[model samples]
Target: MAHAQDASLVARDDIPKTFDDVIPGGQDFTRKEVMIPMRDGTKLFTVIIIPKGAKDAPMILTRTPYNAGERAGNPKAMTIGDAVPLADAAFVEAGYIRVYQDVRGKYGSEGKYIMMYPPRGPLNPTKTDETTDGWDTIDWLVKHIPESNGRVGMIGSSYEGETVAMALLDPHPALKAAVPESPMIDTYMGDDWFHYGAFRQMMLGYVHMQTVQKGAGAVTPTDTYDKYEEYLRAGSVGDYIRSRGLEKLPFVARMMAHPAYDSFWQGQDLARLMAAKPSNVPTLWEQGLFDQEDMWGANHAWLALKAAGHAANNWLVMGPWSHSQVNGKGYNVGPFKWEGDTARFYNRQMVLPFFEQYLRDGQPAKLARVNIYNTGDDRWDAFDDWPTSCAKGCGTALTPLYLSKGASLAFDKPADAQAADTYVSDPAKPVPFLPRPVLDPFFGYGTDFAGYIPWSSWLLHDQRFVDGRSDVLTYETPVLTSAVRVQGTPKVDLRAMTTGTDGDFVVKLIDVFPPSVPSDPAMGGYQMAIAMDILRGRYRESFEHPTAIPANTPQAYAFELPNVNHVFKPGHRIMVQVQSTLFPLYDRNPQTFVPNIFNAKPGDYQPATITVLRSDSQPSAVWLPVVGKSTTP
Candidate 1:
């Protein structure tokens, strides 16, 4: 095998630099591609990159559904084409042998692909799943790979991250450390597939990307520019899938069949699986505060591991990043910028040290139990433990910001006993989740002739686009007298009535930028959404047994938004926007009562009069986790 001596040996100077440039110079590594056979006789294509002249170096293994050797086929220089680079130069500089493998049925690997393969007991040796395959692969690498120190560590993000979590279940003896970044632990709960029983409309594009498209080189299925219109025209989700001739897609079909949280969904829940066979493998859970896909997984997994009394080292690190930014060293999200290169800092200060300590027996890691990047404050905060075990005694308290008359968000409870707000929610004219001229290719099809904006950036976009819309009820607190810090989860307690049998409620907690801040002139009065979530009214009582709301009957609905660490500066005002629909991002509720929304027809979609009650008896409010005393002058 040829060894990489310099960039000239593999990549041409004339070519533009890619994510692979993160690997530092002066390191010579050799790459070899092989197909490793799993216990079930499935051949998983694996790529091994070993630092030359290193004796007994610890191995870092990453199993991914994404093609592993697609771009990095050459031994002289490994380059990842469009896929984001996994580890930084620190791992290569530290002389760790890196191994990347294509999981079962992905890329060159053999066997049928089952998304989020269910965890089954190892009692049956003949049967194989991700856990068994991971165990077998690790066992094979430790024994067959030359110059290996026998210690192994696993790390990946997104789908690959789920693979890392899967390795934790019945791990091999050589597997010493595991870092699962933004893994999807559950689909139906708070992860990518569903939010409070509401199916993610974006899953259409995602499923097509993974299932129908066989290889890394596969182009997006749609040629149109407006994905929203395409979906809208396709009518109901079931109709959309059938119209696209995707009814045979295993995952999509299964997802539609199980509208409620049933045994099928529960079987794929990684958090629950981890509790069943917990491994204390010195795991580090990394998540992004603004991760559009799997933010809920890492938190739930960490909590489950703690509850299971797993003794090995476990820690959590969160940053102001999107699903992809967690790996890159960027400090900005769209128009919002942070203080430093948080991703680089995390890799250098926390991630590298973690692997060194566990995989190489280097200096002991001094990382806190929980290290989080406070977004608004633009600083890192360390806690001995999450939420409850912070420096401050009780961590933070829920400060209720009530929805008051005059469309105001006040700290005090509502004074009026009969105050209420009403709006007409029409599926035909649903509120745009992002500003007009939506450039997202998923909304139009595969082309965004207008500059392409990554979906993750939408989280940080200004909310002013929908603030003036009558369908969106806006409430804002008076310009803050002092900076208010919100450190934990925010909950929305809503009291409302819908004319339709079923409805969807969307709430966004925003930071209203003051005009004085000159970071960006256009940012003046920018309503930056810090946290938000949605709930399908039919599933209010129980996710397992959904019941539709009776017409004109007021009901209480509540759901917790993802945890956040943000500060509303003194000059800025805290705002909350409430709406029934977030087009394209989530499927529009048909409003009419139906046994299965997936099968609902176009006639099922209707406009309904939605009323939000803010009376003294039913005060609708957003509860924020206020931290520390007011920083008022």
Candidate 2:
């Protein structure tokens, strides 16, 4: 029976200490749990990890509700109860048979938790979510485990990176290969409960104070328990959702009571359910250019699997950690650092030689379809795609800098009888992603933390910690003699007009440096470093259709901005700030779109009117994709 469950988990004694000390190749292999089933009969609940007296090997799945037995165990734990176990050790010592599971309803599985996945709406040829329970747990671990070898590969990260893109839909014909780290594909554009349309609100109120007010197994520890108790569960999910009043199970109130994009997140659209065809297996994507929240679902699932011509073998690996910050062990990052052997060069050269060239015996591994990690010159570059035509640019061109009055970033443009910059977002005085009593360096647990928190120049060199906030709005762009690279995703064309009936806009792109000549005890001087992105403006014209911009008249309101490479140097200065609110990185838009603001009501609140057009015939810009020159090798 699967070789006596791998010979009674190698005569267990809790073989812990991570399979008895940092698994190099401990007793060949063994560790069980198993349950499998699926196709709606539901069972799931795996663990696997095999190899022991090998028979076939090469089966590496993951599927997680965060607890695939705490990723096989040993995710580094120093103290605070010390338990660190997480297996799948570099794809089980590069030989294979990893497994993991749990996904169905989470822990010890059975069913009924649906936190996210194909259970939000439409698409029902008759039931079962998470891609038909990942094609029935890869068709019963490729026809009943026994050292599996039917060639399969999958990995994890956030929600086990959306269960490796929901097992790349229509999967399991013996799967083949997959990776997924930092995944989401679509939690309504701007993954994980919203951003750039706002509604992330204090990391979904710290993910409902670590999942449903610390009830389901007391505050965040599922994904199969054991990320070595993340810094002693740090602020234990805002102290157990403020001691059980439950703060209304906030996931930004289920993403602002569904601002359109109905089917409640379109039935967990992981890139239109791993977009049809082109996935003949072979895929690997790991993202995090400071993961500002699931980095646009791993850049829209690596550009929709290279525009659906998939044929497997596609790879990607962005870094600077967070959201699992380069997997455990105080991964600091940013401000200018790197040396931890680049996080063990992805477990001794790209995840155990990509499971020894596709589950052993089938050798090939010449990797790198893109292996980014250039936090503006920190190093590690290798691409065949992702902006690497030497980092192509030249499309976004919107340049209007505007916003004038005091905080500047001109190209002129403002005075058409200008006035707005107001600011009074009193969702009880929010605006913190670090920037108080000096706090610059952060990377790991960002998107404002719940997971993925890495590389944070404190939202780019502290503009006076969001300029004495009234609801934020600052702009700058002076120095610079030459050097302005950028890269992609910029959009900001907002010819706005709102008196209420829906409102929000948060764009922030900063770069403005020149402060650490010994200054930077956390922003006392100049140091703005996030030359990246922040976008959010109410489903900005179709995240499934959110419509609503009447009241005062004028319209057109875009804000994309999230792909960046950075080079704006010369003297540095290219800022672009706009605001409505970023407090809690989102979730304050209550200019009125009610139904749930934790029982809102201040008379349902209202008092909005924010425009920033820039006319010359309605010119409103900020485009700038610019990349251009590159001979650097």
- The window of 10 residues in a row where model 1 has the poorest summed lDDT is 75-84
On a 0 to 100 scale, what is the lDDT of residue 620 in model 2? 55
Which tens-of-lDDT digit does each residue in 273-375 have in candidate 1? 8887888789999889888878699988987887777634789888888885766665788777888877888887898899999998999889889888888
What's the true lDDT of residue 236 in model 2?
A: 25
- Best prediction by TM-score: 1
lDDT of 2 at 359: 64
lDDT, residue 93, model 2: 52
Candidate 2 positional error at 72, Å: 14
